[model samples]
Structure formats: C-alpha cells, structure tokens
Target: MKGIAFDALVDLFPGLGGWHYVPVPTEVRDAIGGHTTRGLIPVRAAIGTTAWDTSLQPMGDGSHFIALKAAVRRAEGITVGDRVTVTVSRR
Candidate 1:
C-alpha cells in the first residue's frame, strides 16, 4: 500500500491538527499522589492537555504508560508547538 504524505494526513481527520492533544486524565494523576496544585495539566500556563503515555494511545497501560505534559499552542487561532514531557515512576 502507498503511504500518504505527512502534511496531507491531517486533512483526513478534523479532530487532529498539527499534533494530537489528549486531556490529562485525573485517574493517572491520582495514582501518583496527585499533583501539587489543582486545575488541568499539572504544569502552569497551560491551556488544555493531559498526562499520558502515547500521542495516539493514552488508554490501557496502567502502571506502564509514561505520563507526559501536552499543551496545544495555536497560531492565528489554529494549532502548533505541541510539547511532551516523559516521566518515570519511582519503585
């Protein structure tokens, strides 16, 4: 099968823009003693995002998924500059 160009992929899925942004689920945060403060996204100055293991798959991976901070940065009311912060749990 032929693969489509990277830039042309977003045209297929309206939900997807420049990057995939998952809402930081509370369950994951609650597992690790929760965040020090309240509000979505443990980090500061964030609009919307969640701590998850993967950009495509955030579900199913208990005690295995690497929670990271993801935020959507938009340009001209669009989207860009998505960041990821991977963390390791202490055993």
Candidate 2:
C-alpha cells in the first residue's frame, strides 16, 4: 500500500495535550483488508529505503490509518507530504 504522508492532529480527553502523526490514507487500508485485526492493522512501513514495524489505527468513524514514529521519520528524512509505501501481511 502507498500513501501521501500528512500530519494528523490527535485530540485526547480534556486537559490532555494533543499529538500529531503521519497517517495511511483510507485507500491504503482498503487495499489491505485481510490484514486488519479488531480495527488495528500491523504493517511493515517504509519510506525511500527506511522501514519499521508499526500498526494502523482506526478513526472513530471507522476509517483506518497509521502513524509514523519520529525516529522513522527522522531516519528516512521524511515529514508530512512525503510519500510512503507500506507492506501488510500475516506474520
């Protein structure tokens, strides 16, 4: 699966600080339905030549996406707007 990286603003409970993430778009999720598990999807994410293990998250509305860790982003020299390719399969 492939997607354009973008910053996702996360809003937690009241008084809690929000966070940001780079998400996998809905089309990518649709491309890997067989890998979904209880709304969470495990994936091997890569940008350019950098890769890492991570999981995809579901929005409250049922759309699913993934977050790129800061380390991965820094190592890959990627930020929001960068394009990434992700691989999902049974372990």
Candidate 3:
C-alpha cells in the first residue's frame, strides 16, 4: 500500500496516563480509510529511519492518532511538542 505522509506535532494526551502521540491529519485518515466506530486499525508507520508496525487509534471524536512509543521517540531523538514527519500505510 502507498504511504501517506504528513507533518504533525507530537503531543501528550492529558489525563490519560501520559500517552504520547501524533495526531493523524483528517486527510491522511481519509486516505487510509475512514474513521472506525471502534477498535484500532493496523498500520505500518515510520518516523525518519525508525519504523514500526502499530495501529491507528480512534479518538472517539471522528479523528485518529498513532501512539508514539518511548523507544521510538528515543530512536528518533524526539519528545513531546516536537514537530515530526510521519509516513503511514495500512497493514
């Protein structure tokens, strides 16, 4: 599958036990497929040279986000609040 690439700001989800993520743009979500009523959508994602197979989680507000694992962030030298370019494709 072709990957959709976009720039996003890494952010921390407040009051959710410190979940870090990058919000998937609506266009990118639409490109991969539309919003899910429930459950996560499997995906392959890359940030620079770091890549991982994860899932796109619905935010329950008609949007989606990809959780940024601590190891991935460490490998990419990124932290919350950093802007990043992410490439994602359906798995």
Candidate 4:
C-alpha cells in the first residue's frame, strides 16, 4: 500500500507510563489494515526530518498508535501536545 500522511497531536498515555504517541487516525488505521488484535505492524515512519522504523501498537479501543521514541522526539524538537506531521508506510 502507498504511504499515508497526516497531522496529529502528540499525546502522553498515563497507562503507558507517560509514553508519548500519535494516535493513528481511524481512516488511516483502516487503510493500513490495522485492528485491535492484529498485534504490531512493522512500519517505517517519519516526523519532520527524523525517520525511523517502528511498529504501530494496537490499542484496546480498536485503534492504533505510534509510540514516539524519546530520541526521535528530541531529534524533531517535538513534545507532548505538539502537533506533528507524520508519514507512515508498511515496511
């Protein structure tokens, strides 16, 4: 499938011990064939000029989120509550 791009707000999940993430929009999740039971989907993602390989974590709410590693966030100068443009594609 082709790459998907969108803007989303960075958020911290308390349950995940304050880990930051970008919620993958429902439409994008569907486009990527993501489901709650699908386990992690390997992907290549980019934010600003920082690019990395990570997996999209399926959430219990039938959604998925991309965990933002601290290094990636620091490289992009991003923080929780910031709006970031994300580009993702299955690897």
Cα-based TM-score, every candidate: 0.22, 0.58, 0.89, 0.87
lDDT of 4 at 52: 92
Ranking by TM-score: 3, 4, 2, 1
lDDT of 4 by residue, 1-91 (tens): 2389989999998875788999988787667666445588888899978889998888777778999999999899998899999988878
Tens digits of per-residue lDDT for model 3 on 1-91? 2599999999998895788999998888778875564578899999999999999888888789999999899999998889999999988
Pick out the ten consecutive residues of candidate 3 with the lowest summed lDDT. 30-39
Candidate 2 whole-model C-alpha lDDT, 0 to 1: 0.55
Best candidate, lDDT: 3
Q: How well is each residue in 14-76 modelled by candidate 2, as lDDT tens digits?
A: 355433345455656666553343477766665556767777777666566566666766776
Native-to-model Cα distance after best TM-score fit, residue 61 in candidate 2, in Å: 1.5
Q: Any runs in candidate 4 off by more than 4 Å, and if so which? A: 35-37
> Which of the two, 3 or 4, has more TM-score?
3
Clashing pairs in 3: none
Q: What is the C-alpha lDDT profile of model 1 across 1-85, one tens digit per residue? A: 1111111111111363433333333454554444423432232212223222232223334311222223322311223233333
Ten-residue stretch with the least lDDT total in model 4: 29-38
**What's the candidate order when arranged by decreasing lDDT?**
3, 4, 2, 1
Model 1 clash count equals 2
